[model samples]
Target: MVAQLMRSELPVLIEHFHLPTLPIDPDDVAFILCADNGKATHLVSYDNHLLELDDRYQFRICRTVEFLQDPRVSQAR
Candidate 1:
């Protein structure tokens, strides 16, 4: 699956950011975090470690349920 994905035009997940500092080794955490930071948007995740990055990154971190319902969330179009 990874090889097939790499061969496509879609961005490979791990290439999204520098992952050397990740705490739990889950690529999803880094992927979502970097995307939000790059876009200046909120990060919605179930991971507790990720939720703790709000103060450091100037972005909101919320559970997926809360993020989807927040009035501030705007689709990127």
Candidate 2:
């Protein structure tokens, strides 16, 4: 799946992006790094480690339902 995705134009092939320094877990940082590198307007996740953040980044982070119900989320979609 990863090989196929990398071959497509999914924009998952981030090269020189720098990861953000968050107090959360290291693995969670990867999620943030990807979103940041992709210049995403939002960061949606189920992990408490990512959701419980102090809302530090310019991007917004929320759970599944929170993201779904948010009218603002439509802009992202």
Candidate 3:
């Protein structure tokens, strides 16, 4: 995956964020946006910033407490 990510030109964008480079590849912002558009899975986030993306991404803006009590999460176990 590191090789693939390197080839995808993601390292440059990651560097722009001033984040330290790591061995493992992190998911790209564009990929996350595409995933939301495709309705691939639930986008779980407690951050207020995620609310701004809700309209565009069709993501569920859940609180930390609500996420913890969601039955689907428990069922996966």
Candidate 4:
């Protein structure tokens, strides 16, 4: 599954994120940092730390189901 994901077109790899990022959990910061640094359109997660931050940054946070249900999401894909 991981290999397949690496081959997928939706996800992109980022080299690094500049400092002075969010103040949330250091462990979970990567996810937010990735979205922030990449200027992502959407962030999908089951974690509350990230979900609660829907409007806090450039991206919109939602679950897998919500993402799939959105017409805009399909168009983006």
Candidate 5:
């Protein structure tokens, strides 16, 4: 899967990003920043802190299952 992703055009490799100070966990900030910088429609994760920030960010935060079940995600495939 890693090799496939590396060769695919679907991924955007973020080389430089300005880290923002958020109220959430330090380790999770990178994930949020990546999603935000990538202009993602959905931020998928099982972390409770991220899930709780669902309506706060530019992107929609959801669980892995919820993301998989989203109609938009399926339509994008």
Candidate 6:
């Protein structure tokens, strides 16, 4: 599946946005920024800080399993 995705046209390269002053962990900022700048619908992770920020950002923050179980994700598949 990974190889197939790599060969497919679903992957995109996006530029990193400037850091924001978030209350969560500093190291997790890049993930949030990437999702925001890329206009992603979800940001999947297992980090407690990121999960705690579920409703704060434009994108939905969730665990990997939750993301996989999402109806939208299933529909995409």
Worst 10-residue stretch by lDDT in candidate 3?
16-25
Question: Global lDDT of each model?
Answer: 0.62, 0.71, 0.51, 0.74, 0.79, 0.79
- What's the lDDT of the predicted structure labeled candidate 6? 0.79
Across 2-75, the per-residue lDDT of candidate 3 in tens digits comes to 88888898745544432222213344454445555566435566545554354454444466676567787678
TM-score of predicted model 2?
A: 0.61
Per-residue accuracy of model 4 over 23-76 as CA lDDT, tens digit each: 365567788777777887778988887786776676778999998987888997
Model 4, which residues run further than 4 Å from truth?
1-23
Residue 55 shift from truth in candidate 6, angstroms: 0.6
* TM-scores, all models, native as reference: 0.45, 0.61, 0.35, 0.62, 0.66, 0.68
Instruction: Count clashing pairs, candidate 5.
Output: 0
Per-residue CA lDDT of model 6 for 13-47, tens digit only, reads: 43454534363576787788889889899998888
**Considering summed lDDT, which 10 consecutive residues are worst modelled in model 1?**
14-23
Instruction: Order candidates by TM-score, high to low.
Output: 6, 5, 4, 2, 1, 3
Candidate 5 C-alpha lDDT tens digits along 1-77: 87888788585554544643363676787888889889999998888988888888777899888888989999999
Worst 10 residues of 2 by lDDT: 12-21
Residues 1-77, model 2: lDDT tens digits: 98998788686633443544473576676788777778876788878888777377767788777778878777767
lDDT value, candidate 5, whole model: 0.79
Q: Give the winner by TM-score.
A: 6
lDDT, candidate 1, 1-77, per-residue tens: 88888788697554444432354546556555575558756777777777665555556667878777767764533
lDDT of 4: 0.74
* C-alpha RMSD in Å of predicted model 6 compared with the true structure: 9.6
Off by over 4 Å in 1: 1-29, 74-77
Candidates 2 and 3 compared by lDDT, better number = 2
